[model samples]
Target: MNIYSDLPDSHTLGLEMYQLISDLYPICRSITGDGVRKTLHVLQQFIPLEIHEVPTGTQVFDWTIPKEWNVRDAYVKNNQGIKVIDFQKSNLHLLNYSIPLHETMPLSKLKEHLFTIPEYPDWIPYRTSYYEENWAFA
Candidate 1:
């Protein structure tokens, strides 16, 4: 009666999906940037995806497109010079749409911008400041 009942084993399909996710998980993706382009390119290998690059300042509805923000690298180091959070390890370490900055600040000051879900302390949250003039790290 159900079309899904005629499909292959769910375990096999789940394994295949997990493999696909593992292959693509490391890509750094943002609303607009080379990361997004690279992600789409990888996805295109398995599926047909049409990508369009709208120029900055283009108007859509009542909002104008913001300039593309592409990050090559970002990190936060402790006062002792050990990197506590490195984007190279995971893109999630860097805040979305963060402007380029390199400065040494005390942990007390930095903590103000850090976010965490108390209910899931071990999990990192994906954050974005696409329209706000601010930055945050998860």
Candidate 2:
């Protein structure tokens, strides 16, 4: 009676893990948002999680809790009216927890805020400005 013998094969387990990642990869998770709640909800299906919520502006250590951010849509368009970056195509196109703003700026100015990984030029970098009041797109 070996419990190990009842487990799925390595290949099957790998496929299941990959499928789970694929399902969760696209979720727009942040420090606080429906995305985070949704992710926790999905995870709760596998393991019990005690979800807790602290009111905005609650003091924690040296910093006060900032407002929770959630974006429904965001994008940047060139002067000619073509979308240069669209959140719809990829959430990476928008910085996480970005304070919503709609403004037209020159490409040079916008480039100042853009971040990229020189080592992984083709990869969309994961970035966040949790404590700072700023935003950027990878």
Candidate 3:
């Protein structure tokens, strides 16, 4: 589309766009929730916006909108009750749509839900079970 064709392709513009990406990177976002609202609010500062709130269960063609899902905060603590992994540090550490888990489980059992990128050992992976009821760590 020739919509944004008026925008320049200059290095300064690229840097400004990068800044916006950096600003949005840390937000814990999902397909639905306040994170999405917070994101749109941020965008409004740079552009005109007309926000629309679609209720849960609203039918859009053959699909039904699911309930809004938001994670105020999530973390996994060790046996000693010390936080080992947190969503605040990296939102990708928590799988999307993970139900609240606040119980102690054996590490071996927990490993079944924990995921990793074997090829890229240094990187944390992102997983989702949006259409199903499941939970995991990344």
Candidate 4:
């Protein structure tokens, strides 16, 4: 299947919308409680929304909002334990919903879950966890 078709365009209009969204992006925004409330407040100005929030441990369907994955930083080190890539430098460097692992592993073991795009191997692919436990570079 061609996944690129599902990707958003990076053209002029798309870029403009992206810039607008970026300008309004609230980093460190929590998904529950006040964070969500504040977001709804801002969103209401654009489109009225009835706010509803499920607490941290509530289950719905086959999924539950996993404990807010608010990561401050993460990174990988080489065999010598020297830092290779740091999440503080770029959030995409760490896998979202990763279980806060800090130990070092050989490349072979880490490769099992790592993801890379051949077109942009160095670029971190946007990955999110809404249902399952997974960790990956992409």
Q: Weakest 10 consecutive residues, lDDT, candidate 3?
A: 64-73
1-138: candidate 3 lDDT, tens digit per residue: 799789877987999999999999998888789999999999999999999998988889988877778987788889888888888889998889998887788899899999899999779998988778878888
User: What TM-score number comes out for model 3?
Assistant: 0.84
Our tally of clashes for model 4 stands at 0
Candidate 4's C-alpha runs over 4 A off are 1-52, 59-63
Per-residue alpha-carbon lDDT of candidate 1 for residues 1-138, written as tens digits (9 for 90 to 100): 788887769899899889888877888887788888988888899799998889988999998888787888888888788987888888898778877777777888889889788999877888888777776677
Whole-model Cα lDDT per candidate? 0.83, 0.82, 0.87, 0.66
Q: For candidate 4, report its TM-score.
A: 0.58
Off by over 4 Å in 1: 1-13
How many residue pairs in model 2 have overlapping backbones?
Answer: 0
What TM-score, computed on C-alpha atoms, does each candidate reach?
A: 0.81, 0.83, 0.84, 0.58
Q: Is candidate 1 or candidate 2 better by TM-score?
A: 2
Q: What order do candidates take by lDDT, descending?
A: 3, 1, 2, 4
Look at candidate 2 and tell me the lDDT of residue 26: 81
* Cα distance off (Å), candidate 1, residue 59: 1.1
lDDT of 4 by residue, 12-129 (tens): 6688777657744634344444545666776687687987767777888976765766666677778787877767566666666666666667789888867778898778776665
Q: Between prediction 1 and prediction 3, which has the larger TM-score? A: 3
Least lDDT summed over 10 consecutive residues: which range in candidate 1? 129-138
Q: Candidate 2 vs. truth: CA RMSD?
A: 2.1
